[model samples]
Target: MSAPAREVRDVARAALAWASGRRADFALGEDALAADGQVDRSWKPLGELAQVCATVTRHTPPGDPLHARAADLLAFAWRQTGEGELFLRLQRLEPFATYPLEVYAALAAAGFRHPAYEAATATVARTRGWRLTEQEPTRRLGVLHAEERGGIHRDEPREPALRRTWLGGLPEPWTFERSAGYALTHVVFHLTDWGRAAGGVPGDLTDYLAHWLPPWIDTCLDARMWDLACELLAVAASVPGLPGDTVPDDAWARVAAAQDASGALPEEGDAGDPAAYFAHHYHSTLMAAFAAALTAGQGVPV
Candidate 1:
């Protein structure tokens, strides 16, 4: 039910290799550069690449091949944002929109800095409007963490925010559904700082997840929902005392099997429409890399 560290490291390297080869595709389009046009297509993907690659670089030390490649990919992703200037420009263009800051947080946490963006964001953070911005519970947690990552103080408390989330409530296990699954995983991600702060997950929720995550992951796998399944796997890896028991041998094997030889993972059972491949499956592939890096970084033999 397990593989050596190198096996999981191979998974991490392959996924980053694939991402590095596709680096150009993650660039900001002309429209996105000028305005908020096609953000989901342009900005979101780029941000995700930065986030996952940053995690890979953080977990893998400098000498390792995986670390070197992941660092290269992370640097490439940073360039796509014009070396942090683009985020500053976007902050001006969409003062209320938090995506730019949220995306910037990944790089910021990885030691990439943008003084102008930080100053502007700090000014905004002091506004009453910023504090009162309406957001779903999970996203609210995201913004709070983003502010924290950038060293901008938000006059808000996190515990109350946690108590408001779907995962925070420790909701009925059977009521779990697709949208709710993503919500819960993100809750874990934000709570644990995407596995950097494993103890951040409350003990009760840790126990709750230890009991429920396996079946939840199985359900995603059963539905052939590779993306969410990978996300759920990431949740398992992020929680303290969960990885050894929660991540089943077959779960990693199934996810690994779904990965293309080129390292892209399909959203579902298979990679559909080769012509639009990366567009269709980029997030899932990124999730696979994210999960793999976290799994391996924890020193768990997957």
Candidate 2:
């Protein structure tokens, strides 16, 4: 296997093992269940697990046991909760939030094709109508809205409007700033579905990513922001026809180097204490595995 592909495979294997081992940290337990038989609003870990597993399943090889295991975990979580009803209750409880929409998107991405999931998704979509216009000040919300629409609905309407919003250019004075980098990467991910829908990305937008991504990756790595750097790698992996070298060969290597032997990557280089393992590591490790799977899946050479 090529170096990049091999790196992806190794990282993915380690991440899956790590995530599986840490499932108890995120999985719904009896104590988390509501006495009233409603989905507990405090059980945020379920959503996190759902998204993580969904990413794993999406990028990992088909027929891999991890895929099935992740699916089963998602199903178990959903069932343990109130399923569609829980989502509805959650939506009513927390309107104007993007997380419920994100959960539906993750389940859909993972190929969970239940009617209840579909219904819950449609409810959320209708409730949170497309917030993709430039007027939406929180760029992340716009990106999240786009992700739900494109990832779940597969309906890329308002093409001209979307082009106007994203293709106009990234937020001005872009730097290695962490939040800015994350917002930029998420906009690209929503546009490209983390490389699964590259044809949907506009030429100008793709060019914009191509121009800024390399430097952004370098800056984030230099800063030891492993999670954000992995997200930038994911953006590079998404742009179609961008040369492999655009994503530095050591991009994945740098992220892998930061990972603990148990496969968790701290949010930053200095936060690797085992006592705070799950709190510090899940997001970055998940993103690293996600980047690896996404880049490798594209058959892109490093």
Give all candidates' CA lDDT scores: 0.84, 0.64
TM-score of each: 0.95, 0.78
In model 2, state the lDDT of residue 6.
69
**TM-score of structure candidate 1:** 0.95
Clash totals in order: 0, 0
Point out where model 2 deviates above 4 Å: 28-45, 65-69, 76-82, 113-168, 171-176, 272-275, 300-302
lDDT of 1 by residue, 7-114 (tens): 566667677788888888888888885664988888899889888878877777788787888788778878878899998888888888899998899988778898
Cα displacement (Å) at residue 16, model 1: 1.0
- Number of the predicted model whose TM-score against the real structure is largest: 1
Q: For residues 165-190, what per-residue lDDT tens digits would candidate 2 score against the true structure?
A: 43344545454476667666766666
Query: Which pairs clash (backbone N, Cα, C closer than 3 Å) in model 1?
Result: none
Report lDDT (Cα) of residue 65, candidate 1. Answer: 84
Q: What is the lDDT of residue 299 in candidate 2?
A: 75
